[model samples]
Every structure is written in structure tokens, then in C-alpha cells.
Target: MIELTDNAATELKSIIDKEEKKDHALRIFVAGMGCSGIQYGLALDDDVKEEDVTVESKDIKIVMDSDIVGGLTEAKIDFIDTPQGKGFVIDNPKAASECGSGCQGCQ
Candidate 1:
């Protein structure tokens, strides 16, 4: 299950409220491989595919593809505000020692 911290939920809701797309759900999926093994993508989407898993958080619907569920099962989403900027951060324990695609040194 993916968990969103209070700050993440509020921040995401603010962004979603400003989008032009209405009646759409937030789609969070695994994108290309990252330095940590897997990268995630977030978008405003309305299409719920047959293999998608829908999770509700802070009254918002977050959808993810079924195939990525295992890797992101206990992931946590949080918002961070640093001196440089503010953004969303996904803390995925499963990716602690992950290696991205095309990396030959990681196992």
C-alpha cells in the first residue's frame, strides 16, 4: 500500500485543484529505471485500466499499475521544503540498494 503524508496529500490536492483536467484521478506509476532502481511518474489521468489498482488517500484517488505494486507496496510519499525548492519525495524502502537500468555493476 502506498501511503501519503499529510503534507504530501495537501500539496498534491492543491496542485490537482489548479489543473484544467476535471473528473480525473491521480495516476502514479513506475516510470523508467532510476539510480535507485525504479523511478515513479505522477500525472492527472482519468483512464483506469483493467490492471490498475486504485488507492484512496486524503479523499483523492491514486491509481497505479498492478505490476508495480510489489516494489512499491510500502512506499511513502511526502512533501519537502528545502532552501533550494519544494517538491514531492517518495521514500521507497525497497529501493534502498536498487540499481537503475543499464547499470552493470549492480546486482
Candidate 2:
């Protein structure tokens, strides 16, 4: 249940085309850490674990662990290129804080 902007889809396609692995997918996950408790991660993954989930949108396939699916259903993945360089940008509605949201001892 995630959305990828046109720019993001295009950028991701470009990366996938140039990578050593072509059948892999763009993996996005919520990890425990960041200035704000949880940070978003993006990478290329060749396989999905039993707990992982995936959604296809705008010609892009997004893969995430099923455990994080409920909380991140409406997330948005995008790409941004500037003079500084290029990177992936995430917008998750479920994130209480930018990165460090859940209480350390809690989640």
C-alpha cells in the first residue's frame, strides 16, 4: 500500500538497470534507530523472507517486511537529485517522529 512518485520510479528503474543484479527489488524497511527512534532504509534485495511483503505501483515494485506493513501502509518513496548528490526519500504517515519515534525500551 505504498506510492512511488514518477521521479522515484524512474530513478529506481535506472538503478536497477545498472546494478549487477537485475531481478532484485527495491527494499524499504523501518529499522530501529535515527535521530528521531526509527529510520527508513532503502536497498536492493534479491529475496524476500517469509515475513516480507510487496506492492507494485507505477511500474515499480516495493518490498517490505510484513511485520512493518500495517504501520507503513501509506508510505511514499521518492528520489531526489541535487548538487549534493542523489538519494531516496521516504514519507511515512505512521512515523510519530522523523526517525526515532518508538520508545527505546518499548519497541
Candidate 3:
């Protein structure tokens, strides 16, 4: 299952509250495919497709396409605020290993 770190859940909740998106669910999707297997993206979405898989973690509802769920199983989503940068990151061991260290996306 896709899991969100505590920090990510907090930050996501804050953003949802700030944006007045109480009715929306966090949507994760396959944004693209490169040498790094698949790139995922997140967004607040109110639309839920018939083929979507929905789950609740840390009180946050997350939706993703059924076909992509297997690749993201056991993935963890975290928010980092280091000096270099700050953003949400999905740590998927399977995807990382598949991508290896050669591609720029993997690096």
C-alpha cells in the first residue's frame, strides 16, 4: 500500500486546509515513463474514476489508478525541507532498483 509519512500527511493537510480543498482527495498518478520506470505526481482531485483505487492513510484519502497500484505498493511519501530543497518525495524501493543509478531521473 502507498503510505505517507507523518510530516507529509501534516503538510498535505495544511495545504488542503489553506486551499479550502476539504472535499478533495490526494490523487497520485503515473506522470511519465523514462529510464526511471515511472514518474509519479500528486494533486488535489475531486474526480474519482471507476478504475481508481482509493485508500485512507493518516486520515487523508488518496486515490490512484488501479493499473499503477502494483508498482507503488509499499511506497512511502515524505516531505523534505532541507536547505537544498523542499518537496514531497515518493520513496519506492522497487522503482528505484529498477531505475538503477545511471539515469538522471534516478540520480
Candidate 4:
């Protein structure tokens, strides 16, 4: 199952509150393919299609397409605040394992 870290949930809640998107759910989807395998993107979406799977974690609703749910199994969403920047990050072990030493996108 996909999970969201405490930091992620807190940050997301803040954004949702600021944006006044109380009805919107966080949508995760395959954004593209990289050397590390599939890359994911997150957005606030109010639309839920028939093929979508929705779950609640840390009081946040997460929505994903059924097709990509399997690939996201055991994945964790985190928020990082480093000197470089701060943003949401998805840690998917399956995708990381698919990465080779030559991966440039992950670097």
C-alpha cells in the first residue's frame, strides 16, 4: 500500500488549506519513465474516474489510477527540506531497484 509520511501529510494539509481545495484529493500518476523506472507526479484533483483507487493516509485522501497502483505498492511519500530546496518526494523501492549505476535523473 502507498503511505504518506507525517511531514508530507502536514505539508499537504497546509497547501490544501491555503488553496481552499478541501474537496480535492491528492492524485498520484505516472508522469514519465526514467532510468529509475517510472516517475510519479502529484496534483490536487477533484475528479475521480471509475478506474481510480482512493485511500486515506494520515487523514489525507490519495487517489491513483488502478493501473499504476501495483507499481506504487509499499511506496512512501515524503517531504524534504534541504539547503537545495523543499518538496514532496516519492520513495518507491521497486523503482529504485530498477535503477542502474548510470542513472542520471536520480542524481
* Consecutive 10-residue window with the lowest summed lDDT within model 3: 97-106
What residue runs in model 3 are displaced by over 4 Å at the alpha carbon? 96-107
Each prediction's whole-model lDDT (CA) = 0.82, 0.79, 0.91, 0.93
- For candidate 3, the per-residue lDDT at 50 reads 98
Question: Ranking under lDDT, best-scoring first?
Answer: 4, 3, 1, 2
User: Judged by TM-score relative to the true structure, which candidate is superior, 1 or 3?
Assistant: 3
Per-residue CA lDDT of model 1 for 1-107, tens digit only, reads 88889999888788877885557887887777656677898878989999999998777788888988888888888899999998888898988575655777555
Model 1 TM-score, 2 decimals: 0.83
Which structure among the candidates has the greatest TM-score?
A: 4
lDDT of 3 at 22: 96
| Deviation from truth (RMSD, Å), model 1 | 2.9
lDDT of 2: 0.79
**For residues 1-107, could you state the per-residue lDDT of candidate 2 as single tens digits?**
88998999888888888876678888887655655546778888989787788888887777888877787778888888999998888888776764344446545
Total backbone clashes of candidate 1, pairs 3 or more residues apart or in separate chains: 0
TM-score of each: 0.83, 0.79, 0.88, 0.90
Please provide, for model 4 over 1-107, each residue's C-alpha lDDT reduced to its tens digit, 9 standing for 90 to 100: 99999999999999999999999999998898788778899999999999999999999999999999998888999999999999999998877666676777766
Local error of candidate 1 at residue 28 (angstroms):
1.4
Ranking by TM-score: 4, 3, 1, 2
lDDT of predicted model 1: 0.82
Candidate 4 residue pairs that clash:
none
Error of 3 at 86 (Å): 0.7
Q: What is the lDDT of residue 71 in candidate 2?
A: 70
